[model samples]
Target: MQHRFLLGTRKGLFVVERTVHGWRSLPPHFPGLQIPAVLTDPRDGAWYAVVHHGHFGTKLHRSADSGRTWTEIASPAFPPKPADAPDIRCPMRGVTIPWSVELAWCLEAGGDDQTGRLWCGTVPGGLFKSDDHGDSWSLVTGLWNRPERAKWFGGGYDYPGIHSILVDPRDPTRLGVGVSCGGYWVSEDDGATWANRSDGMRAAYLPPDQADDPDTQDPHRISRCLAEPDVLWCQHHNGIFRSTDDGLSWKAVPPPEPSGFGFAVAAHPIDPETALFAPAEADVCRIPKAGRFVLTRTRDGGKGFETLTRGLPLDEAYDLVYRHGIDTDATGNRVAVGSTSGGVWVSEDGGDGWMPLPVRFPPVLTVRFV
Candidate 1:
């Protein structure tokens, strides 16, 4: 079977196809527009892409024939400011803030049985839902109107955004989302109501006593095991974390060697005990730890992690993998990783080994197998 990979980059979106011989590249779809997120619906083979224009704002596009063509769709927008809407204040710092929706940070396909249903997470931290595929979208007001949102702050950007959305495969009504600088949230009733589930996560940048505060926790990225939705893996701002109760609570997981701080994490499609992470230095410097590139895999959950570096750069290499830049296929054996420096690599045997794709493109924002 042929494998298809979608590479979202700052300049556009590229399609990488792999055959028995090797990998082949297709022309970029949205040339010059920043493509932060893209997903292919397995239910009907529809493709979705998030296109962000600096001055024109962000938009969503869909393609039925893979990446050959696309149609722009209605994008998520914040509701008109209410007359009584008060300026939001940082919960911990007590600073008045002006928050507005600026971009769609992530896109996710719903459960296998929920055809045409889609989920979107956006900057300024809003969750949206679409029952008619990408044609129309509505803000999940239950999450937006939460009182806890008033305290959320941005981890990298000026405003916190939900960059990870996980729809429980076992139950379509259950959902989870991760926000930068904010915390993790779960909804058991199809997003009608939300609650913070970041119990054990920490925010090292905050006061020592405030480190464990849910609102102060920064979850860079979160991934769930397809085989066991209750198991989740997170690459947090301070370190790695794992949760066995569907994100109700989390525990710190030490990375293999250099550091545990990184942006991306991917769970094995079939094994709840396996996962992959791309490690980088802490917030002070986002390069590969100690100037060496490696991918760490844990087959026994967080009990132990092994570093996989063969076929990867060994010295003087500085590549930062974004939160959505690493992904594994349904088989759980094929893994693809993209770097912010326009480098791409693929591993057919899980994280055991890797091979670089022949050509380089723009700064990659995300990578996924369709």
Candidate 2:
């Protein structure tokens, strides 16, 4: 079987196919869209993409026949303005509606009875549920009306931003997501009410400026494993952590180095025991390992860590991988990583070594197998 890969970059959406001549890139599906997400919907056999749609906001497009044709889905629609706050009066504080959705899912893989519903996590951070497979979406009021959430968000009009949304593969109703300064939240009733899931997570790693508030306490950097639902893992600024009971509780998993923070974590699809992460010395600096680039791995569930940087660069490495920028192919044999430095590397032998892919894509944000 031939497996295609999609790369979402700041420039646009790129497709890579495996042919006799090796990997080749097709023309970007939406040029200059600032595409963030490119995913395949198993329910409708369609490819869905999210892109920045100019001043109007981010837009969602769907391709029914692979990447041939696309139709815009009515999303990124912000709520209406209240009578008290008119645009003309507050021209300096002009409010632009957010039309772009952050993350999208087909919900087919979610192990719930209610499959086929399209789910999206957006900025300004709220969950959107679509019953008609992404044709349209309605914001879930259950999460939007949380009384304590406002107070927890520092009483600001703009509380936080959502980066990752994970719907339990075994039970879709049970979902978990990570917010920039809001920590982590889980919903057991399929997008209804959510409870904070940051018991063992720490705020010690927060930067000097944001360390004064609740942002550090939040699980600012988090990721979930599909192979082991009970074993939820996150690579935060503080360190790494794993939950045995599916986010009910957590324990710290420190990296090899004490001063650095990790951004990306990739779990083995079949072998839950094996996982990979990229740790950088500085959050702003993208150079892997401060010029000594490395991808660390753990086989015994974070008990011990080892450096795996054979083919990666050690000098003048410009880009560092982000949280969502690393992933494993379906076969579980190949690992791929993208960087803010505008390069993509593939490791066929599990992180033993990595080689650059054929295409010269832009700073890659997320990579997924199709």
- Give the number of the best model, judged by TM-score: 1
Q: Write the per-residue lDDT of candidate 1 for residues 61-170, one digit (tens) a residue.
A: 99999877789999987678788877887665566544566889999888778778899999878899998997888889899888888878877677778999999988
Off by over 4 Å in 1: 90-99
Best by lDDT: 1
lDDT of 2 at 59: 76
- Assess every candidate by TM-score: 0.96, 0.84
lDDT of 1: 0.88
Clashes of 2: 4
Q: Lowest summed lDDT over 10 consecutive residues: which window, candidate 1? A: 92-101
Model 2 / residue 257 / CA error / Å: 4.1
lDDT of 2 by residue, 216-297 (tens): 2444445556677677767765678777787777788766652246677777766666778887775455455547667788
